[model samples]
Target: MGRYQCHLLCRWFFTQSLCSVIVQQRKTIDYSAKQNLLSYATESSLDHLGYMTDTPRLEAQSALTTFEFRLSTVLTGAYTIPAGTQITTGNNVIFQTDVLTEIPPGSLSGTVSGHALVPGVSGNGFLPGQINALITPLPYVASVSNLTESNSGADQEDDDNYAERIQLSPEKLSTAGPEDSYKYWTRTANQNIKDVNVYTPAAGTVEIRCLLKNGDIPSDELLEQIGNVLSATNIRPFTDHVIPKKPDKVDYDISIKYWISTDDKSRATLIQSEVNKALEEYKLWQRSVMGRDINPDEIISRFKNAGAKRLEITSPVFTVISEIQAARERNIECTYEGLEDG
Candidate 1:
């Protein structure tokens, strides 16, 4: 009887020990099944989908700007700044000349296109005077500086963005006459674009309004680049007139006062910090897309989720935004109204 009881106990303990491992294995199998679907796929699975759809992820882009080369004195002969002459901003970020440039005899300087060595947003946003250090020294070359702000640098497409593009790749099979086709091509031009609004206001006219990732109005440079892409003979319909422009911005402000529950007064400071964080997140969600309405109700929900017991939003009443316009936040004021009875 004792030996039978010991065997039974050992069997029970072994089964119990295997339960957790069995559950984990089941979870892994379920997750692998989920990745087979496009919506739930990530990383390598998403990349595989992109490959099947013939839409590869967009790669990081180098920043392009203008660099001017100066001489100590006007020389009798033209001074040539060879292509690939590297320049830096004293920091590690560097730019190279895109083409060979010449300072004509009697001319003090000449400008050439500059391309960033690093390909990503990190190489962007340098002001004109920021890139003055020459990595390659030349005879009589007094200085080298960017003539304009560094622009057109973009990061590689993230998984979510790439997935969206893959979803839209079917539209590319058709001519650019359809709105979705134009949108797919526009997104393919730059990975940083957030939203696209296509409108045919008149016969043969295709007006495209682009909104950047962070509610930044599209720069003229970006608009021109998209325009060039859409203007290609094979891409644009013969009757289509493509005009790329920035979406009109509808400015709005936020002002909110919130109170914490007195029952939870011990966490008042932590809740206040969380409420502030929620407000900024709300602002980002509000402006990141085109045609998103300004809704104080969203603010109220976000604040409440952050442990705000009550909120009084004075600004940002619900406003309808047109498809061709984006909401922009001009100002924000948030006040903590102290603990109150819940």
Candidate 2:
């Protein structure tokens, strides 16, 4: 059952006027007609003979959870270690060499880099000088020092993310071979890809830039997979050459001042909390899609609606960039400039 069909069903079960009102005010209704419609259409229905439609699963993205550490050795002889040699942390988390390295003849130590063999977000978010213990004890290997910082591990996708992707399926299916096609294909590869910008620089060349939801760089493996999928004959025209790349990230700094009538510390705190929440929501809305300009008016409206007595935006005087670029909010700073006299 689609929305129209659900509406008809609703009308048949209830009064036509009531069903129309429910459909119109679905946004506020606890049991939204749109949601009910999706449930009926995707799930089993008496008219459809109880066959459930397939839904897209939420994708899990791997974070670079481990960092490369320099290995210092006291052994006074040339030694060659093959690529993929395992090095273990004190907690037994495994790391593998990214490339083969050879200690020069008569050299005491050489530099080598490794990454976590296991994917997904886990382990203590270790910083430099944190991982000192090695699982495999070797006399030649004297000490290990992390040269770079390790990112905290991430978990699998949640239900809310899964539903959001499923909602985009209808629009994706409607697109033919335009920019929307590239966006749809990229999203199919990974749901964490929040924004995709497509540019046709030449007659035969298409560039697709993607931005991750978590604001981190996409891994090389993920980029390769996207390239492979887009290169398929059925997915893209043979005459067109596709380039998959990451977008240039631009961060926005926001400062807000709002007035409130109350002088009570707790009441002021509550208003500040609401304003902060609204700003966070605005950031999400701004980055929800690609090629969206940063509208300062929207921010002002959001603050005013958050019970601000008088609102002034000191930063982001105007829209940041055109729709061609992908922009993300790096941080937001809000201040309540004392109570208002009104």
lDDT of 1 by residue, 91-200 (tens): 89989997798999999999988778989988788998899999897999998899888877898888888888888999888874998999999988788887888998
Compared with the true structure, all predictions reach lDDT values of 0.87, 0.63
User: How many clashing residue pairs are found in candidate 1?
Assistant: 0
Candidates in order, TM-scores: namely 0.84, 0.62
> Which residue ranges in model 1 land beyond 4 Å of their true spot?
66-85, 97-113, 135-144
User: Which residue segments of model 2 deviate by more than 4 Å?
Assistant: 1-61, 65-84, 97-119, 123-154, 163-178, 214-225, 228-238, 262-266, 329-333
RMSD of 1: 3.2
Candidate number achieving the greatest TM-score relative to the actual structure: 1
lDDT by residue for model 2 over 14-39, one digit each (tens)? 78668778776764564434444544
lDDT of 1 at 24: 100
